[model samples]
Target: MPRWPYLLCFLLICGLAQAQSLYLHSPQGPLRGGVNEALGVGYFLGIPYAQAERWKAPLPASGWTAVREARYFGNACPQRGVFTTRLGGYLPPQSEDCLNLNVWMPLAAPPAGGWSVMVWIHGGSFTGGGSGEPVYDGSRLAAGGAVVVSLNYRLGPLGWLTLPALQAEDPQGSVGNYGLLDQLEALRWVQRNIRAFGGNPQNVTVFGQSAGGMSVCDLLASPKSGGLIHKAIVMSGGCTFVRKLEEDFTFGAEWAQAMGCPGADLACLRQVPLSQMYPPEGSVLANVVQRVEAGGFERSPWKPHLDGAVLDKVPLQALKEGRAAGIPLLAGGTQQELWGELLSAPGDWTSFEVRAEKVLAGKGKAARALYQRLYPERPREAWAYFQTERTLLCPSLEAARVQGEWALSYGYLVSYRSSVFPDLGSFHGIELPLLFGTQNTWPAQAIFLSAQAYEDSLPISRELQRRWLEFARVGEPGWLPYDSGKLLEMGSELKITDNPYQERCGLFR
Candidate 1:
């Protein structure tokens, strides 16, 4: 159980095991992955679980006789618009059949108890990002006494083209929501087969950031996802938008019509190339889903629909109605995410003033007027507070409030900052490395070579693991349960803070 030396040896062997045998029993055939000394673990990367019919809904993978070569990553599902993707500037091949998951397991399964498993869902407004990103390297977290799983979900048009035309088709007949389905299938695979890799299926904690955080909230709201996962942690944010059934049926129909699909019908939609499906630039909804879109596939919009099963009702309602799976919850956002999301923007009011005005208009003229009066000059703090409400702070508190009615829920704010990205505020998604203790294997391997970086974050990583693993093992994450009245602020120093945030947060009220 000694920590530092235990992982020290593994970090030394990262490149040596790149070709390790990784064949395992997936519903598909056997798959392969590489191993790394830096992680001191065995890994299986990019294993597919399901397939889709061009623009049609996703289908379960076809069973096979021999194992599949899961070594190199399968193609990333097609996405659209240039944004924060996994590979970013790198353009690898793309495809329609991109439902893959990655696994990192301890070389040793820790005697008989095995290891706690944490499945990570990458965030890109549910449109971009992949399992292959170096930022998500699981070696660090796995080395911290757990198995780690990260997966790629369909984003944008390829993943969520819900339209009435597609719904009229056969087989319980629906269109869109491919991303959520892909997650359900991946979790199912983990439940059935993770033990072979030394992970405890029943002790699984589903964790994610941003859109991934939205997915976590939805999964908690899902009956199908219940029992499959025992604990949940959400970072960055949670779900706010839920699609009406009629709205779901028509969004894609409109897009398909715009695409020149025959009468906005399913047949024509089923024929359009997945790549060309994103809404054109300057479109109204496109702006809403912009931050979520990535690559060239287009339309990585993140909203849960009434899928009839799996996700029967929208998450906000389900949680309030006490319909979601009652599991332990750990949730929160950063201290300041306004300037964080738009990190490149200046720290002054002029940079964010216009944007603030436009955003407040969405809240209605009176509210806009009220907001402008209070925040007219747009001090740098106003914009930053705006992001905290929409992204991390408000959603985290709301999710805990809703879920706490039925389950044990602990809330927090990751007030820590990366010494690396100094100007980016505490920022969105910065905690990714902190959560996994992978600061060394970050944006570049050069970071790990720096002794100061390792020294600063290793203890932080251990502290996070202590809280995270404890939650995975039991239910509470070693903090006071969150409620409207009182919540815990977890940091280098811990304290009970109320509302966790307000003013800008109170705007939502």
Candidate 2:
């Protein structure tokens, strides 16, 4: 009955157990992995799918002569240690040589067509995330009968830097979007090599949360990325946002000035050490930037911008015009995001109306009236809920509406509030552990679950994983498409409901 037993059992199963060796030969070379007997899964860790130089597209991994040991995770992309991934543990030393991926294969024999593959792209504002986090450990998912993958790409200025000088120097005339290129390269690797790991490359499903989810959206609209991602799931991913290459280059110019180099000096910029590009921690600028990115409220400087080659135009516009890849899409967000509490700031009727007016801007009157009508007494809660609708939920609805018109599409709202951080509501990235079925493995329990909700959360976790795996296996996740303007609200009662905030969303549109 005690929780300690469950905790200890999970630790014993996931860690400290001596692993059995497993081997597989692929295009790259023979890879050596470790088997978790308890989970009946084999893990191939930290395998490089490509090699990438700074400010350049990734190249295929070099040929290997010997059996490479893939028993440990590769380096995470260079990033500040501001955001805590998964358990908030110490990360492995960051590196530029971080274009690696991890794979998990079921020990059980595959079916006739091979197991379905799900590639996970992590979220850290495109500046701080790696595939090595424990919460993303794929052994459990593999055991549930699928091939799982997580990968690391370039991050920060290295991943998305744009400069007129660099563009001029490049033969391809492409600048920025290296991180996205790394993802494409990884998918190509999967197409070439996943068959060796008992995975059907043709049945691949790409899914990610937050920034990674935004990458999925980009891929949807990118002609270069077509046929690679068969099915897609975008979790906590916002839509209707993109930047021009010129706009992004301005940030590069600022970065150049900060580094004491001329904005147009490509050679000088390349010569600067990675450490000096971004402050690691403790600096005022770095702290402010980290806070804003972490808030999940605004676009961070380090993100995939509209490079002419990779992305011809904004994804939303592409989707609207039916230029998007038109694959099956599952996109939605949490019930409450980082702006919820701030939007819910204590205020009188007049102040609440003022704040609503400022937030809604052009569409102020209707949304504010709806908020007042919905939560007459709880003005703060109403405003907070409205903030989520305006920024995340409604945009996601628009995405679903657009995709559903042409392709099989599903939408969900993770309405299960965290018992731990009740004030934060469902919060961003909260669905990750649930989807991975690793909520208990989170090192910081307070951030994920409360003592009272620990046991109660397991069923929810299981259901979420089941639905996601279902979606990966087939295009459908046991839910109807949002064609009827109904979304599956994932909470204590998982059922179809009319999509929320229709009136407010209409005003925004």
Candidate 3:
């Protein structure tokens, strides 16, 4: 054969292979994905899993007949953007029609059985955040032998508002948990469609951080999510925290009044412009302070509540009553979750003492004395530690204790501080970059890690990914369960510790 003819044949073969790698036949229809040539991972972005009208349950997405090109991210659910160091200080385009998901898988053929699946739910206090956050790119994790999926659910009032009128509109009488319902629908979509993308439908691990973690716990408790979730990971979110539906009704009434619909009028409220829904920044902070001062640190109007239909009881109560009995759970928080807050507050020893006395009121002087003894010199560190324990760590421990009694549970504490911003310590969500292997690349994380720091942290990142992938594949993260009263600590060194801070947590309990 002629040399030119041979060259043309080779090019044709290469093109066919590339085309085949980017195509998959999902249950809904055919999909064409984009490939990350560098990593050899195929990513299908903005795949609509379900759709819903305002304040109603999500329905399966309408089917399409043609090949759908999932090459770009869908619109972010409507939200008022907030700049944060963790989210890289930007937001994507927003819209009400944002019930879409993104998936990443290795281009190579699946192993026997199929690749394990991990579904990520991003957190923005249940108000903001979408699946398209750069830090959440799942290509790296998918390349490591698991299918990674990230999704967007409804947010803010559009997702979680509860009122008597809205309840009446729902046939099942479910209200105030539309965001959570959206997640359940997404899982159902996975069960019906993931196998087409080379994933094992029977082995799905739903993992999330913050608000997303809380959703994981809710899923574990929801009867609707029984077969959809096989394993779960909750990061920096407590299982026990949720609002009563009655509380939401009261808040809804007040919100309605604020929005010029004094009777909680559904039609009027629905007509209210989206721009008017977002409260002023100052008002939000004030509301948070009021809730904290009233000792409802975990309660928020926008968070999931115990709606009778969607959630028959408080999530923690259900868990204690064996709602998530057989589901293996890995739960933990960063060691310095609230340490960044201290940077904006007074750091004097006297201020710390005063704050402790006020916060520990009624607990007695003995408790205060013990706390002081625990951190005699570092006043700011002591206060930050106190908040971290009360708000996140202790609640996590309580949830782990209940889960440990019923099924396999493991706990961890991330104590690694970023070398680029050592002052922040292991602040909230510091583990995200390492878990996604984006520390040196994503701008939000790269700003906090120098070239040397990224290199040094590579081993820790790899180890974290390994454990998570192992947990998704099987049911365990390779450490003794929380039933053993030991948790694996990750930092510069990884070792098992006997559940640190229990004594201080006991003071609050």
Candidate 4:
């Protein structure tokens, strides 16, 4: 056979495949999407899901008559700071008109009903991050016989600011929770339109990390999210952590006053420049943290809050009362949530004991005895483990236990240390790249993992994807539920162990 003939045939097949995956008819309109030939996935990026004005509820995206090109990502919601710039490199153009989402679906024939849908929400403390981040690319996950969707909701002050003036304007007097409302609207968009993209609207799973995880819990609790979400995966986010809208009113007033709009004058506040929204010397997060400390509340104020109309009760309370019954829930965090800064320096058993004594002040002696008993010999690691349990692991487990009472709930703990950054052992967010199979796209992988380490982690990555896909498909992640008193532990080895940290967590309770 002539080599030229073979080459010509290959080109013809490639052209036909490209044409076949290029266009699709959506309920909203005709869309032109791009395809990853190598991955055999069709991607529709930057599709507008809704439209909203600052401090207002999102409205359905206007239908488009012409074919819209969804080849590039949409604008990220307005955000600033090192978290947005240095860490994720999400330097896309910013805008308030950013209620858009991206979708990736397998090009192959759909399963019996339709492909299971997984919606991703990125996390940056509710102030930064967007669906456009490179690490969030859904091609690999979508390639695993699923439809993957990621969205951009409002962030920072623009997304959450609440004031009396704003409340009075709302018919229900709703305040704060605007960002959460954006998420709800996105889910509604999915239900109305996902089937057009070869997804099962009834089998949707919402998953997120950090602040995004927190949003998942919020959605699970909201009556507005009823029937829109079937399964939820909350990573490193506790269920019970939310404040009342009234609590944020004071902060909002102060912020407005600081911006020269005393009394939260809506007219004047609306006129403030975007640059002034997040001043360079101090950030909205810093200001909120200061107020949070002054108000004596332990939870971060930047996240979603209970606006009476949007959320009737605290998420955990709602779960305990069976408001979210029958919804399968998967929730957990890393083994060491805040390892880098806490364990950055060298320390010995004596040093750890001294630090523990100071921190435990009133109960120093008893605390020391308990610590010694729980984590003997490895004194320095004890502090990191305790902090992790208190901040991420225990809270997550507590939520799972409560959820298990009315639903099939699972808990997980990721203890897989990176070979390159061994000292940062299973630090916060280590599971993301592994689950998405986006190790090559993750910024941390470039900085930390060598090519060989990336290769070695492939099996683990694939396993995570399989487990998560199975959960989305059949509401089981190939393990027993949390009520069984066992939780899956993912690390160098994978196993289901009797719940760890019961005694340690009890101390906090």
lDDT of 3 at 338: 90
**Model 3: residues with Cα > 4 Å off, grouped in runs:** 1-21, 85-88, 279-299, 344-361, 364-366, 441-443, 446-449
| Alpha-carbon shift of residue 319 in model 3 (angstroms) | 1.6
TM-score of each: 0.80, 0.90, 0.90, 0.89
**TM-score for predicted model 1 compared with the true structure:** 0.80
lDDT (0 to 1) per candidate = 0.65, 0.77, 0.80, 0.80
Instruction: Supply every candidate's count of residue pairs whose N, Cα or C atoms clash at under 3 angstroms.
Output: 18, 0, 0, 0
lDDT of 1 by residue, 1-509 (tens): 43444244344333234456544554455555666656666778777666766545556666678756655666766665334343243323567767777788777535344578899987766656676666676776787678888877777666766666555663665445668878887888788767656677778899888778888888878776767778888886665644556654545545565667746766676677653565456766455434333322112234556767546776767778976547778888877655544445436554454565465555544434544566676545555566567556786667876788888887777666545555656666666766776565535333335577567767766777778777876777766787645655544444567754645555554
Model 3 agreement with the true structure over 1-509: per-residue lDDT tens digits: 13443244324423644643476667788777788878877889999999998788999998888989887888889876534524455456787889999999877667665789999999888878889877888999998989899999999788889898898888988899999999999999999988767788899999999888889888888878889988989898877666778777888887777777889988898788776676444676436533432423355687787877778877767889999988888989999989866775447666665666676686545554765688776666677788888778776766777787788888999998878878878888888888998775455555455678878788988889999999999989899998687898888767788887667767766
Better of 1 and 4 by lDDT: 4
TM-score of 3: 0.90
**CA lDDT, candidate 3, residue 224:** 81
Off by over 4 Å in 2: 1-19, 85-87, 284-299, 343-346, 349-360, 447-452
In model 4, which range of ten residues has the least summed lDDT? 1-10
lDDT (Cα, tens digit) per residue for candidate 2, span 234-268: 88775555567876677677677766686457778
